[model samples]
Target: MEVRKLHPLFAAELIGADVSDPQNRELIDTVEDAMREYAVLCIRGQGHINDQQQLAFARAFGPLELPPGNNAPGVKSRIAPGLYSASNLDANGEIVALESRSAKIAKGNELFHADSSFNDMPSKWSILRGVIIPPERGDTQFIDMRAVYEALPQAMKDRIADLKAEHSYAHSRRKAGADADDNLPMFKYMRAVQPMVKQSPSGRPTLFVGAHAERVIGMDEEEGTALIEELLAFAEQPQFIYSHKWQPGDIVIWDNRCTLHRGTEFDYLRYKRDMRRANVNESGEERCAIPAEALTQHYQQLSKAEAAN
Candidate 1:
């Protein structure tokens, strides 16, 4: 496999390797090594991969998280349990209405975030495959947290080194002008407290703040928001970012532990952009085992209480 650097700081494109075959141990190891170095890796021309093949390849990293909203009643997903539908299409294979709840919720994705940061065990690797690429626009932009951390002023780094921030899916959605209580399985009132600076698997300290990060624990609310925004502004500088344009059959893998990503705008109402993603949890020891039935039940109760109000 040949590696081509996509950006000065952290992303690369790997050529001459097929990831569809999960049993290729050498290929998997090579990809993992590349991830430690690049933080983000794109393997183009993977349009031939089927759902089963994609899941198998994603599992090579670790156990997969059940896609959000998979437990919704009567919703049959084309992409299967382990893969999250990152597309604008509905379960019926139709483009969702712009005013629909799903579309509104998706607006939150436009803000940079580490996947599943609100969960107790945040995700590790997010492997996304482009099934239907739009003719133009809709690129995924990534920020290298490792680089961002390194560029921070010493005093700023010291200030955040021992601080913990609260992350919530609801908080980010609300920030995006979407309803926090939207009833999506993942949108429920859940929060995870994580250190602002954490060691990545690569042994580098990374800034963990993102859109999902609500506030720094023990600090005044407004003060925490200011700090988060300041760090985000610093990280948004062009030199630390890589924007990946999608191509049908392309599979892009990013480490959520050391990167933040956001989707760029596209003519979603006119074009079909079917992207599916499989997320691997941070570790096998702390794998999230939230039962589908339990999530379904919790949401049902929430809905009932809302209706009563």
Candidate 2:
């Protein structure tokens, strides 16, 4: 398999690999090394990949679908449980489950923060394949956090080096048009603490910023909001961003631990962009519920009042 860089830091397209039945141990190592070098890898000619084949291929890098607390149907938390599945619509004509027990416990792609960061046990990697691409508009846009960090002005870089942010699903889901059930604030208490910017495990400098980042650890609410927005503007440059026009049977993997990604909006009302998502858990990572102490006084009091009611 030949590895071709798709961007300065964000993506690389792998050609000449039969991803459907990837058995060559050497090829797997090469892909893993490439993934380490580049946060995202796009393998184009994945015509023969089934769910099991895809899962095995993804396992060469690290663990597969096995999230400690976050589990999904037809997927088990094993080294290679064939976690690779379609993230789009299901065969019976249903939306790729936005509301459910597993997903509620396991945060879906609602925020910009990395995947599985809330559950003390975060995931290692996420491999999503584009099984059925739309005719005209099923493009996934990826931003390079590594590039974002490299391009940061020295002043800003120094400011965020050791900073942390509050990540929550309730806050971000509400922003993304979910969170309708006010009584059941399942996401209100789901939050995570992660560094704002750090050197990736792969030796790449990446800014771990995302929509779920509620605020900087000590900054005022408004100031925190402004800071994240500013970073968003900086990282989302057309020069640093890559807009991949997905094709059917395109297998793509991303390192959620360090990168922040967003699925671009399309004409959901007119078009169907059915695909499946599969994530591999990273072990020994600790996750916790949002602390009551960290909450604003108003929301803190509300929790008390609700109990009395």
Candidate 3:
């Protein structure tokens, strides 16, 4: 496999590897090593791989995260259980209307975030395959948090060295103008607290702040929010970013532990973008800061009460 740097700081294009070939242990090991060095790797030419194949490749890295059970009632997934439909297509293989709930929820993706940071056991790797690409203008931009941390002023770094922040999916959804309230299942009340600075698998300290990060712990609410936003703004600088334009058959693997990624806007109503993703959880025992089962039961009760009304 050949590796070409995509940006000065991080991200690379890895060529000549057939990720779909399960027997290729050497390729998998090389990819893992590449991920440790470059936070993002865009493996070229993987369009021929199916959903199962993609999942198999992702599983080579770590345990895959289960698909979220928060889909609208009666909307079944077109893909397999472990795959997430990161596309604008509905279950029936049609483009979703702009005003639909799915579209609204997707608006949150435009903001930079570390995948599944809201969960207690945050995601480690996200493998996304571009099955159907748009005609133009739907790139995925990534921020190298490791670079961001290195560029931070010493005093600024010291200020956040020991601070922790609360990351919430619901908060980001609401910020993006999506209807994320207590009516939703797991996201509404569940939150994860992570240190503002955490050690990445590469043994480098990376800033953990993102759109999902709501506030710094023990600080005044307004001040905490301001600080988080400031850090995010700093990370958004072009020096720390790498934007990847999608092409058919391209699979982009990113380490969520050391990077923040956001989807760019495209003409969603006019074009089809069938991107499938497999999220791999961080290596450890499965756990959640909030009780997932209790939250699901609460949502069910609310639905029942609303039905009776």
RMSD of 2: 6.7
Collision count of model 2: 15
lDDT of 3: 0.86
TM-score of each: 0.93, 0.77, 0.92
The per-candidate count of clashes, in order, stands at 2, 15, 1
146-176 in candidate 1: lDDT tens per residue? 9999999999999998999999888988999
TM-score for candidate 3, residues paired by index: 0.92
lDDT of 2: 0.64
**What is the Cα-based TM-score of model 2?**
0.77
Residue 229 lDDT, candidate 2, scale 0-100: 86
Of candidate 3, the 10-residue stretch with the lowest lDDT total is: 283-292
User: Which 10 residues in a row give candidate 1 its minimum summed lDDT?
Assistant: 285-294
Q: Considering every candidate listed, which one attains the maximal TM-score?
A: 1
Q: Which stretches of candidate 2 lie over 4 Å from their true place?
A: 21-23, 65-91, 94-113, 180-189, 284-309
